[model samples]
Target: MNAEKPPGSKQALVIIGMHRSGTSATTGALRCLGVDLGNRLYKGHEGINDKGYFEHSDLADANDEALSALGSSWDDILLRQENWWKREELIPFAARIRSHIRKDFANSSIWAVKDPRVCRLLPWWLEIFDSERISPRFIFVIRSPHAVFRSLERRDGFSMEKSFLLWSLHYLEAEQWSRNFPRAFVDFDRFIEHPAQELARVEETLGISFPISVENAAPCLNQFLSRDLRHHQERESPESSPVLSLTHALHQSLLGAVDSGQPDSLEMDALWNKMESIQSGFPRALVEHIRSSGSIQGNLQITMNRLMRSWSWYTGKPVRFLERLAGRNV
Candidate 1:
């Protein structure tokens, strides 16, 4: 088989998926294995992530700002123009973004950068990082559209129409990219349901092994990991958390569809369960706030609240972005 990557900058992993698709948790899981996670890590973000975000702060912010300059935002960037890549002005501008990511992550081996925005800019990455020096192991996180639209509507107050559009665009781009590379599709729901096993599938695809100490990183998994370490792990039942079961059921539904050899339904269900499972971790109060917020505007507001918190963790600016947007330029 013809190889797309060359010998030796080490085979690095790149996580591609929409936002709220368990990218952070997966990054943490991989760190638990043996990967080098650059020079810094973002602290836990509020509203969405209770733990933290690990993507590069500036890179994310730059992408956000660029979208804003086009009079739309990330939520709506995909639908605005299919020809953003063809913009002559953006070529050199994007090249700089590529150079920066490479320089910042130069020291790491078998590194992975997980950000949904990166998927949209694949052509740019392919242009800049096409060299054989960097062997990229692509990992795509697949989640469900129903859950994604629901979550986007819930978290961002997006209109069902808007959420559906975004959900479809995001996953379609992800699916298309998956076809072009040596990639692994991770069921977000399953990864959370059986993190170790799901992660092992990714590890095997990348030809790597996770470290034995990953269990020590999260206390919630103590009982789960202690039970089996091999096949299935036992999990605690929480009285206040029936949502976990809903998430898991969604996973089984999707897995069963795949087992039945229905590729189309399997793919669709996989995306839905993954998104739903990740959101199941949110506090009950947050879920209610989303439900009551009603539609696209409400959901966007809620998601932005959480997103601000995550960006804060990534950049160590408690209210930097907020202040800057407020004209304070902090």
Candidate 2:
């Protein structure tokens, strides 16, 4: 954290979006604008996300633990229950979040945190923010559901149907939770094509300014928001398919509202209803399949680790004996 306060310093910027939906790029762009992402950032995996995730590790871990307490994980489409905020378990999680803020962001005036898991956990975070007297600004990044589905398939081995539902679940939660806060929506495709314009819109809409000038930020933006970074591009509009039409409609509506500077709650509510209707009919078999696969994968990994340990233990003496023999022969 920097000692000096920058112009238009916000208390915190929370970037909310589904996984593989350009949250990392949005966070990286904000970092260029001089938003502190705290000292401990998730470097992100090499092949999956060569560019950094820009999410604080302590906060992210806390969110993971919080999700687990709520009977959810990052991969689960069904996040917390409707009344999750009232759960007694969240009390400790909120305390942990407060400690993390004190430890990681104590010296910063304007810091940002981005994690896809935060989409569903906003209620928990909001409680902490209110208790701690921290004002939060939100940035929601949305990509076409088709693109998100493809990316999830390649990365997580998720089925197209499961991915679509997960994307819908995340965005629905984000929209519902973030309505009270000052928020700006960035279309991932448009942001990639014209990052400066989108970021400028975010600044103006949120009533915050970047610490650095657009000229300085431009170079960093170029380095971060390149076309090659986008792994999945929608071949046809998501609206063209029945499975993705609701997501596409909701995303377009949110984007329109953000651009017009007035988000329509009634329209958003209607969209949510429609989405819920569709999701009600989502196949239970698919959900079970995904969960079963995950369990099998975890079990296989544990079995492999046990086997490797056993092999090492059994072969240790013989290997050492062979090494001594080789040394004597030499």
lDDT of each: 0.54, 0.75
RMSD of each: 10.8, 8.2
lDDT of 2: 0.75
Superposed model 1: Cα runs more than 4 Å off: 1-9, 40-42, 66-72, 77-83, 208-330
Residues 206-283, candidate 2: write the lDDT tens digits: 888678866688988887788877888885542344447766677677678656865577887777787667656769
For each of the candidates, give the backbone clash count.
17, 0
User: Which runs of model 2 end up more than 4 angstroms from their true locations?
Assistant: 1-10, 237-243, 279-330
* Model 2 alpha-carbon miss at residue 15, Å: 0.5
lDDT of 2 at 246: 68
What is the lDDT for 26 in model 2? Answer: 85
Candidate 1 yields a Cα-based lDDT of: 0.54
Cα RMSD (Å) between model 2 and the true structure? 8.2
